[model samples]
Target: MMLPETLREIIIKSGFIKQEDFDGAVKSARELGKNLTDILIYRGLISEDVLGQLVAEYYKVPYISLSKKVITVDLLRLIPEEAATTFRILPFSKTEDTVSLAMENPLDLEAREFVKRKTGMKIDIYYVTAPDFTAALGQYKKNIQDAFTKIIEENVEKSIGKSGDAVTLGADIPVIKILDTILEYAVAERASDIHFEIMEDSYLIRFRIDGVLRDILSLPIAIHPAIVARIKILSLLKIDEHRIPQDGRFKFKIKENYIALRVSILPGFYGENIVLRILPESTRPLALEELGLIGHNLNFVKQNIRKPHGMILVTGPTGSGKTTTLYSILNILNTTEVKICTVEDPVEYGIKRVNQIQINPAAGLTFAAGLRSLLRHDPDIIMVGEIRDKETAEMAIHSSLTGHLVLSTLHTNDAASTIPRFLDMGAEGFLVASTINLVIAQRLVRKLCTSCIETYKPSEEQLSYLKNFLEDSELTHNFYRGKGCAECGNKGYKGRVGIYEVLEINESMRDLIIKRVSAEDIYKEAVAHGMIPLLRDGMDKALGGITTIEEVLRVVRE
Candidate 1:
């Protein structure tokens, strides 16, 4: 049954916090006039969801889970948006004349009566926990999205009509103005990606913020070429090459902040679609502390980086912040005592005393070829950007075995999978096991905005997962959410943080690896030896409200 998971469940499952600790945190929150969520999250309590869950069970009302169900326009219009807003109830569906509304305070007869008076309809209410309700309600909210949406609308008005699928741009309109308007707006909103797409009707402009996209405005079909050309000129992509896909990179300075955009143009049915990845100036290498590597994961990497001759591999999918972690390691090991050389497709950042080379196979410098040339320089350490082929893989292993510490990244699900991947690339199993030191897998999740975070209990499904995972550990249950805020542009999330799991190749691991066992078997052996998985490390951060469980799942679930 899909019943509400309560505070009692949280208390029983956590097996950590007692009634006394709760009372103390509550008292402190009251004394300091601060959010109880803040106190629980920062204090390392399990989660803030327990109290609400307890109260929710105290009242015999069914719990409602938003984002699980669809909210259609017909249902939303049953009650005036104002009445629903006033009563903190979202009327999402109907059966006959009864309207289903989601609210946390189902016991409030006055609020129910108020909603009834305003709508004059039978009210069928389901309880929504605080954070869920706030988030659901935030969708209809207009504070932050409204302001930005207005800017997009104004831009549309300058060129296209309301339903102008067949609209044409005026010749008087400056082509560069449209390009600047979209990019500046995307940057101002802190979007990580911007998409220019061609639909059956018109051109669409969308931006990816906090890992989700929001469609902002449309442009006339006539202006598509000029817009594409403008971005091509900026990225140095071939403008006239409309029949093929092309990739390029350029840095744009907006309001004194340098923004690097990785531009890709692909041919589409309507026109050439362009996608720009916004790499802000902040991609510069961060210190180990800033990379969000905590606990044993941090210490393991620190210890292995000091080793003179071994390979430390960082694994994750594309855009998973793997480069940042590698750069962090490089920064620490960089000193006058040892020479460090890096061969990257595009040098991300420049550090002092580090020789960084851009891998340009088009100019006759592939990873294998450049690495071969780099080895001739007598470097104490080498950083190959990635090991994609057998040649590069063998070369990297050779570098590690031949008394040079090699650091590189691979496209793998986790550290455990990195072993099998290297073997599949034709490296001998013993050779893979002997020279490898540490394998770190990481992902980036959107950080909750402290300025407008909402607190609530987790659902039954969420509680079940936590119980299974935290069964053997100390658990506290206080969850947080980012309610729409003007400061965070209503996305609720403000920034991103890294979650990591580290695997150190010790005697036992090397033995198992030497046997050429399955990745799953090796993974089990590693875990049995107290290797922390990426999910667990991410959960640690989630417990502190540094991130959300939903966001963590988006990364590790893959």
Candidate 2:
């Protein structure tokens, strides 16, 4: 019962990091009483997948990535839930006499022996990353739909017998439990938003997961008022006022982490329809690589963010991942030598050593006003959440011109149109041309579920549509799509990735901008200068099997 080489030794042998850094992580791991690998991953030193592979190489076992792996319920049932949870092991494949298991620790003989004895078969071991292992373990949890049904059936009777207004039942035990179930499950499912729709006979509960809306439950109309009231009460909104729209937010705790949920209540014919947007707890901003920027686009962002003074504008519609890109850039620029300041409508994340201001129009602290004040702070970098008007747009341009790096977002369809959008906002052509450095437009498309992604030849019509955008149709020989699986909730897609077009303002393009050319003309020049169009970028992803053609078309067309 001997383990393979120590993880620290393997990490050093693999040249993953300097020996001094590994030793420091090992010391912190010992102090925190946590796994060495966990500490490294948490601190953003190494990725889980790469570390898993490194361990598997030393342990002489196969490595598995479970992001898209689909394991059947029957196969999962072979390992008891408690044992699987305790050991971080899952059965992914099985044969007549052999069972293949993916484990976070391939050296855990206890886990291997337990699985072998339970199934009465030879066990084959495979290594899996911590994130993949945790996600796969969710397969053992009870079905969400079943849990929802059970909670409602048990509490419907209590609400059925008594009736007053929403506020009265807001405090009722039955109503509270029902509402709690929805919120709890929504958070558990990684839902971005929850929609409560009032209908003629029933109230519909829907959860928006991975950019798609799904109906979760339907309750009688009698339950609607109480549920709305409960949410309103929790969010500290005016529960009694039903005529006007109301907005508020509240923090919901799950274990040690707190989730901030924004609530919007609107008047409707049947009743008040409510929508709750679940905001994730501020954590580490993803690296640019993880956000789907690669090759030239990645290099463009990297080179420009280091410049001392210029404007970098990320253009996209709402929910298109504009803010995330801004945050990622800020994460790269965050250091002790320079001061960073930001003014946002609502500050999305709290970055250490950065000054962030949330916009309050009511208090006369708008983006324009905030930028003016941030200038006096002698900051090296400034981020404006958005440029919504001429005043804000002009102020941002002015900030960039005066020897300060500026990052901001604007609502535009593509990178080429961003220049014209500035002009439309009444920004001077010379100022826009001189101070602008880069413009990036992006959209999020559902990534094809790795476990169920299927490839096929393109149709003639699809090819024709693509040819209008792609010069070399040979790349379209085979495209991938999700075939729906239990792992992806049968949606064929599991997560989202960004598709971007980066427009680097070179001298030629900058000259055209100062001349006030049309966006179409500017777009042509950008493509000529090696800028990848959004549709082309998405198409490349589709060809690479990162996403489906339909998913790309579905998003880009909008």
Candidate 2 deviates by what RMSD?
Answer: 9.8
Clashes of each: 9, 0
Candidate 1 contains a number of clashing pairs equal to 9
lDDT per residue as tens, model 2, 1-558? 122457557777787777787767677666534456765665557777888888788778999887777678788779876688799899999889999999878888888888878999998899987656766766754455567678888997778768777678898999988887888789867788999999998889999988889998888887787888888889888888999999888888765678888888999999899999888775579999889998899999999999999999999989998998999999899999999999997876678999999989989999999999999999999999999999999999899989999999999999999999999999999999999999999999998765455556677887787687666746445566776765577788888899999999999998999999999999999999999999989988876667887789889998
lDDT for model 2, on a 0 to 1 scale? 0.85
- Which lDDT tens digits does candidate 1 get at residues 1-558? 112346434554566666676667677676544455446544556543554444455576665676456576566656555566577678777778787888867877877887678667898877765545555654443333555566555654564432222212312245555666677778767688999998788888889886678887777775676677777777777666889999998888776678888888999988899899887875567888677887788888899999999999999989888888888888788888999998997776667898889988878899998899889999999999999999999999889889999999999998899999999999999999889999998888988876567667777777777676664343455677777564566777877889988999999999988988888988898889878989988887776667887888888887
Q: What are the Cα lDDT values of the candidates?
A: 0.76, 0.85
**lDDT at 529, model 1:** 82
Model 1: lDDT of residue 449: 78
Pick the lDDT winner: 2
